[model samples]
Target: MNENLFAPFITPSIMGITTLPIIIMFPCLILSTPKRWIPNRIQTLQMWLIRLITKQMMTMHNKLGRTWTLMLMSLILFIASTNLLGLLPYSFTPTTQLSMNIGMAIPLWMGTVLMGFRNKPKASLAHFLPQGTPTPLIPMLIIIETISLFIQPLALAVRLTANITAGHLLIHLIGSATLALSSISMTVSSITFMILFLLTILEFAVAMIQAYVFTLLVSLYLHDNS
Candidate 1:
């Protein structure tokens, strides 16, 4: 496999096509679902777990529907797992590459905007352009709203790209430093190694958090627009 850090970003077509795995992974759940009225023990357990979590959240508040939440959960798990996988030595961080992450973010942003507009055609415009603006400011408001609408995908792309890239770079730098220093001074380099080891845990947390943030923001976008 190509180990070049920047190569994937340069040729987007290669990384751009990676979204297929995510789609294929999630959509395949439908096939595993039982068609008959009766479900096996494992399937029943999964359904119960989903329902239990759904009910608990619904009891607190009803902002997000169960079905959407389930989809969001799947997205979170997929992203988190992919990110963690990339953290392993020599593995490519798909999320670290702008092309891959942006490819994913763009579709997500497009889906959210398309669904929101379809669900609320009138309010879609109004959501972008608020209702209380005076006639004189309508054009200005429209321009602002248009800019804001356009920035959604851009924001998603930059956010994921920056987070993952920074993280991977930090890990690489620390590991390299530890490697270089370990030969001359074991004590100092060991400390650095320990810190880098701790950083892996932090990276794990960040990976999970980024995944949740992405899904949560997507959900909020859908909820607000819907």
Candidate 2:
């Protein structure tokens, strides 16, 4: 049972085909390209959402970081889509894997740090040493600061992985309990199903929020460096 529960997280190696791409395409497949002169429901909703998301991502990035709207938007969309799709029956959540999260985080985080170093060398270096520090504690402070600096990417990766994994695990356990209770007591099973339904809804919200948070953190990192 535990193996079946975690089987989705395991990587697959297939010579013929894989369901991963199809699942990833699910989000894009639902919305069509706006072709009509007067936008329909999906088009209108997409346009409005585009404006809202762009504003959220770009408003604070008025400086050199303004150009990153596309990249950040793509990141958010990818994470959100993967998360939401995983809610469906038999679907897998790639973001739940620590390796993939770390892969996404390190390069972006490194880019921000490199940008800061390139543009503001002294400022980047200054992060390692506090102003007006005691001479004796300087070494200790530098070590602490350096450690903190390097921990940023790991923190981002673990944060997203932890939240998504926990939410899915909860949903899975509750769903199993609902099925198991059906034979014992119809009343209890109904109650459990209701709770499971509410939890699923909450997980849906969590999926989007975590994606937003991950992208927003990346944006903040970029803003600081820019």
Candidate 3:
């Protein structure tokens, strides 16, 4: 069965770009929480869930220090799995949509802004502009940094959307061409199918790589703010 198109698989629902951010975030939220409040009923369920996640992470960090080996591996696996799942024949790649990538970037960008403001209330403005710049240079630097802040989310969204959409379109075009030719001769079509199959596998690899890159950039942003 093409699960990608079936009842539980629901291609249209699963294949949009808007879904990735929520999916990726559910886990990240769990990971970022504190431990002590998990048992408190008055606390929101979201809080408890996050606390449980942070507890485990805290344990790991205590044992392993600040090494990102685990976080990196988890991010790669999670994103790769979702991406590859979309590559199945007749399935849609959510990554191909700009909305999904934007969804993913929005939270990250917001987090960066909030963390900068919350952690360094007085320094948030200075963080972007830096200190000790001459009055004449301040306007130029602020303009540049402001532009950069806006571009960060846009760039993140566009990069993933372009890569995934282009890959899928190329794959589908090739498959369609091969299918038309196959009607004329099985031998040529078979070879083309095999080539296309190999390319599909390559697409799986690309999905994982893209996801990793996206997550890594996000982490870097978080680290910078922290």
Candidate 4:
């Protein structure tokens, strides 16, 4: 009912707490785990996607990265599922919220950084300062790198939030225009509807790609740390 572009993003609270918990867990309820060797269609598709994502990470020869395959897989699935489901009429997209995105980003990013430090303290510390740095500029470089390191999680959060929010807004605007036009001119509305249809399809692809990109970057961060 709210005409605000962000109205859908506002999490409803029935008992003081926000609605994301339910929305976040919704996918797991419907999609069963792919545990059986001879799997059903859903399981088969799940396994295929997991394998595809794993193979993509392995392309960088990140054997350590494989250790996080499960976490990474779950992350991708959660994000992808939420994004797609949001496209359905009257559905809310938790990923569109910066707070929600940041919540997901910070923990995962912190875990990867901590893992790297725990596994190899010296090597992890080495990343703070590049080799062959000029002695005079060492302090400046370290400060810059430190800031950049801390910015990783925020960057991840913003990237996902921006893409999802922008795509949804564009789709919403176009859809609204199509509806408004329909009352004025049938011919123009028909053409606009066709455009809206195509845009929706494109938005679907964007939803999936944004999820993949979010997971892929996390993998890369994990790889670097590992």
List the candidates' TM-scores in order: 0.73, 0.91, 0.62, 0.91
Which lDDT tens digits does candidate 1 get at residues 147-217? 98888877877897789778887887788789989999999999999999999999999997788677766
Off by over 4 Å in 3: 1-78, 121-127, 130-135, 184-191
- Tens digit of per-residue lDDT, candidate 3, span 1-226: 3323123232344545445445444444433334584545544664554355445433433222335445544655455656776677655555666776688688767876787678767766775688788998998999998889879889988987777776777687778769888899999999899988898888878887787677667666655555
lDDT of 4 by residue, 135-219 (tens): 9999998999999999999999999999999988988888888999989999999999998899899989998899899999898
Q: Per-residue alpha-carbon lDDT of model 2 for 85-196, expressed as tens digits?
A: 8899977888898988999999999999999999889988998898999999999999999999899999999999999999998888888899999999999999999999
- Name the runs in model 1 displaced over 4 angstroms: 1-67
Decreasing TM-score order of the candidates: 4, 2, 1, 3
